[model samples]
Target chain A: MKISELSECSGVSIASIKFYQREELLPEPERTSPNQAQYDTQHVDRLRLIRALVDVGGLSVATVRTVLAAAESDIPMDWAMGVAQRAIPGSVELPATTTRGVSEIDTITETLGWKVSPDNPGRGMAARVIDSYVQLDHEEILSVLPEYSRAAMIVAAADLASVGLQPSRMRMSETVVVGTVLGDSLFAGLRRMAQEDEARRRYAQVQS
Target chain B: MKISELSECSGVSIASIKFYQREELLPEPERTSPNQAQYDTQHVDRLRLIRALVDVGGLSVATVRTVLAAAESDIPMDWAMGVAQRAIPGSVELPATTTRGVSEIDTITETLGWKVSPDNPGRGMAARVIDSYVQLDHEEILSVLPEYSRAAMIVAAADLASVGLQPSRMRMSETVVVGTVLGDSLFAGLRRMAQEDEARRRYAQVQS
Candidate 1:
């Protein structure tokens, strides 16, 4: 298929396809002539994945490139998952002043009996939230950490189960990356709705 | 405290404090002179909240203004929460082509016995994710919606409980808004860690 057809089929623009190619996020197509190149269903699929990462996951182009490279690599699924998670925006090192928050997260992970690596970017990211709570003097909010951890374990199990349902290792890898990214958005959205429902149940006055 | 003292206390730069004032994100301080203004503890607290919304919540200055206004208003906490959630990015109305996806989300909410409003931006956001799955031919991923919904309920309960712990209605309103925003980041970070642990448990080989 031509680039235009790729754009039409994949719902990506031609210019973005070219930009992605230049960024090495998309591989070069087979040249049919001096001025023409052909794309395949794989290109379409890749484009869709890129769009999901960018649009839904809200990843930067650089981060999207990182995720795509990890997804395409022949590494173990867990390692690839780690790469994808680390590539996310907030998964950076925290300041030294956040030791208390980091320790609190360590306690939560330990209490959950989950063997998360000490260096998992998620640890830092979660600790950063804890640090924010501490900074705002809202330490009472930390009381809900256990519940959040339990719910996260449940959701992570579901996430892995969903990935397991994919038919191929390649598909599973793609699912792991896409699911890790989009799953956050999905859960966050559902959570807002659920929060509203819970609030209504607890606080809404019954209509006379 | 002067504006510089406010900056020193909040750790926000002098320029950013002025910018927030210009953006109306921060209220004008009591002018001590033609070029000097006095800030207070309230100013410091508001600055912290603004930073949390902008930095951790990744909300725009416009959205931060919306959330601050909602939090400060003499409205019910749940209503304030609605405003905050709606102001977040990706909470906008989805395109009309997403009816199928929206209905799928409706079914999930109904299954959960959650009375979410049809206009809830979360419903639209989650439906957009569903549409992405459909477009990518990854409907198998939807199998986990029930689990995701269950997990969301658990987390939402925690979120509301945390809000309930606040000592004042004003604090509760702030927590409701701040929690709704940062809770997503908090949960996403923890979910990544939990996913890693689960991946290790399911896939890690026995090290000799």
Candidate 2:
């Protein structure tokens, strides 16, 4: 297939395909002549994955390259999961001085028996939000930490289950990366709809 | 309180406070002299909200201004909720030609008996994710839509409950805005931790 066909089939523009190739996110095609190159179905698939990661996942080119490399490795699923979680923007490393928020996250995870590592970027990410709540004097929101944790467990189980359903390790790796990134957007979108629904129910009762 | 005191009290830097003032996300303080102004506790509170929305929530300065204005209005909570939902980045308006994804989302929301409006940005946001799944040929992951939706409802209920706990309407409005923004990050971070725990449990068994 030609680059134009790759663009048409994968729904990514030819310019983006070239950009990804330059970024080393996509592999170079076999040269048919001085200027012509031939792509294949694998290129199409890779382009689709790259588009999903960049457009929907909002991952940077560097992170996407890292994730793609991890996904294509031998222990693809495990490596992809780690790479995807770490690639998540804003999952910063905790400053050594910030123990209070991290400790609160530890307490919650401990109560849940999650056994998550101390250095999991998620720990820092979650603690930062928790710290914001405390800083703003909205500590009451933390009261629902248990419920959020429980809900997270349910969704995580579903996430892993979905990954498990994939027929191949490669597919599993792709699912892990895509699900980790797009799943956040998916759940956030659904949560907004649910919030509107809940708000209407509660506020309607108040009016009635 | 002076600007410096406001920054100290709110934990936002003086420069950022000035930026917020320039953006009109924060109201002007009372001018005490040609070069000095007097800020009160309200300014401190406002700065905290602005920081939460920008830092934790990742909202843009323009959106923060809109959300703050809505939060300060008479029918604050309702307006704040609506504004915050719309302000969420990546909640693009669906093309009119696009009906399949939206209909799919409609089915899920309807099955859950959620009375969400068609125009709700969340509808478009979730639909776009669904469309991405289809485009990537990873539609199998949609098998967990129900589980994700269920978890979203759980978190949404907690969100509204936390907002309801606020003692004043203004505080309620602030909670709605902050919760709508930060809640997404909070849940995403926890979900990552949960995924790590689930992967460890599942894979550790395989290794054993």
Candidate 3:
């Protein structure tokens, strides 16, 4: 099939198809003549996958190349499954509720799995945020839009897996990168507003 | 002290302090003379807090305004506590783990907190990625670390937080905006690669 046909079938633009070919995500078509390049089923399928990741999953071309290479090895999948079994790999989970007025130096040192400074001003807050998240009851999270949030994450995860599941080493290193990006960007944005709301309440309490 | 003195004392650049002034992150300083503005201890402190928010907390200027308003309310702090109690509000929390193969339609519905068509082709894959994340275990994640990979996020988060938190609201809001932009750009790039990787893996898995 021609690139145009592939583009229509794959729901990707003709220009994109050519770009991917250059990026090597789409294999260079066999040249039937100086001006003619013939693509086949494999080309079509590759384009389909590429389109899904770029358009739907939102991965970059460079990261896609890395993930493509990583996924090629059965070893990577084995490692990913292994990591999945232990932790989501590249992530830390924290609870939202806790009386732990910011973790002390020791707590941060331990949590960071390092010997970070004890009096680092920011360290306390970071530890506090982590502690708050860790201490927060799972139910607490549920109390806020109990059904909707999980549904979104789960669906996004599935979409992510369908796009590629070869751990994070490929494509910027997996769920955490994507998750962190989204969490910090989307959810964190919402959370900041929420914090402001909370801070407002705190101020009001002081005044009263 | 003049505005320049405040800048020097606070270690904030003149340009940034001016930006903060323009953004209303700082109250209008008393004008010492027609062309000059006089700053004070309170202004110094406010500048410090503003630096924390913009440089440390990583929030945007707009968010900083909201947060600042919250902090500056005439309402008593005691009254603010009552408001803090309500800050969490209600949110949805679906099953931490998702069923495999839910459609892209379902994924979109869930993310947007609305309904979507199941017949959509990409929906199924979308659900899988999120499910896989929910399914990841702590150990699995730890095992996948490439030497020092385990510490990278910890370090990044710590540094990222420090940059904007000292000024509290202004810096914090800027940090959050940076996150938003990063998500919009970086994640989109990575997801593209993921889709192709998954397709190739599935094909190879079946073939073998």
Candidate 4:
């Protein structure tokens, strides 16, 4: 197949495909002639994965590059998934001096008996939420942390189980990255629906 | 206090506060002179909310404006939060003719007895994840939907309970908006940590 076919099949623009190639998100294809290059099934699959990361997963190109490299590495699936999870774009930066929020989050993780790295961006990311809540004088919001973590554990277990069912290492890595990134939106979307359900049930008596 | 003071107290940059002001994300402070405007505690609080939405919640200024307006409305908290959820940036646009994903999502929502509005962006957002998965020939990934939805219900219940703890209508509205936005990242971050723990446990045999 050619670039145009790849574009048509993947539904990604040629310019984006070129941009991805330049950004090293996609690999260079074989040149069939001075002006033509031939792409293969791998290119199609790679482009689809790239689109899934950027479009659905909302990962930055650099992060996607790093994730792709990790996927291609000989590292264990667990480590590859961890790398991809850390590379997620978390814009909420915590001040290095704020030990309280971090410690509070660690307490929840420890009580849950979950052993994650001290440097997992997830910890800092979760801590940022607590910090925001505290900043607003709504520290009581932390009361919900345990429940959220329990629910998170359930979802995470199911996520890993799904990844475990994949047929190949490459597919597992792709699922890990996509599931981590887009799964947020998926679960958030479901949460909205669930909230609507719960809110309706709670308000029915008031309305009645 | 002035804009500078509000910025100083909130730790948000003056330029961003100005940008939010210009974007109508924040209401105008009272002008005491031709060149000087005085802000108050409300300004500080509002600035923090704006920063939380933009920085941590990853909402667009336009969406923030809509959400702020929703927050100020006399509408029920449920409706206001719905508006905010619908205004979130879901960049993965599906073709207008694409009904398969929407109906597939509807099936899940129906099965769960959720009563969300047809136009709820959460529906579309989650549908986009499904569409991406199907596009990549990983439809089996939907196997995790039930688990994710079940977990989402737990978190949503906690989320609403936290909001119910608020003391005033205004504070309730604020919590609704903040929780809806920041809560996504918070859960996602925790999910990552939870995933690490679960993966560690599952892969322990391989590592050992």
Write out fnat for all predictions, comma-separated. 0.71, 0.69, 0.04, 0.76
Better of 3 and 4 by TM-score: 4
The collision pairs in model 4 are none
Candidate 1 per-residue C-alpha lDDT over B1-208 given as tens digits, one digit per residue, 9 for 90 to 100: 9877888888999999989889987777888899878899878878887877776567888878777777778776677777776766657576677576888998888877888877887887789888878877778889889889999999999988887777765566667767876678789889888999999887776645
By TM-score: ranked, best first: 2, 1, 4, 3
- lDDT per residue, candidate 3, B1-208, as tens digits? 8877888888888898888888777889898689988888877777765554554335557755665665457545423322222222122233344454243224334543422223221133333334443443212321221211112222223323332243543333333333322322222222222222332444334433
**DockQ head-to-head 3 vs 4, winner:** 4
lDDT of 2 by residue, B36-101 (tens): 999998897777767767765678888877776676676635555777667666676875875657
Compared with the true structure, what per-residue lDDT tens digits does model 4 show for residues B1-208? 8877887888988898888788777779899998999988888877776766676567878777777777787787677766765665653454486565677788989998887776766777788878867877888889998998899899989988998898865566667767877788789889888999998888654543
- lDDT values, one for every candidate: 0.80, 0.80, 0.42, 0.80
Local accuracy of candidate 4 as per-residue lDDT tens digits, A64-105: 888888888988767887877776665355558756678888
Score chain A of model 1 by TM-score against the reference chain A.
0.82
Per TM-score, the best of the predicted structures is 2
Question: Where does candidate 2 stray beyond 4 Å?
Answer: A1-43, A54-80, A88-90, A205-208, B1-43, B46-80, B87-90, B205-208
Pick by lDDT: 1 or 4, better one:
1
> Judged by TM-score relative to the true structure, which candidate is superior, 1 or 4?
1
**Residue B70 CA displacement from its true place in model 3, Å:** 4.3
DockQ sort, best first: 1, 4, 2, 3
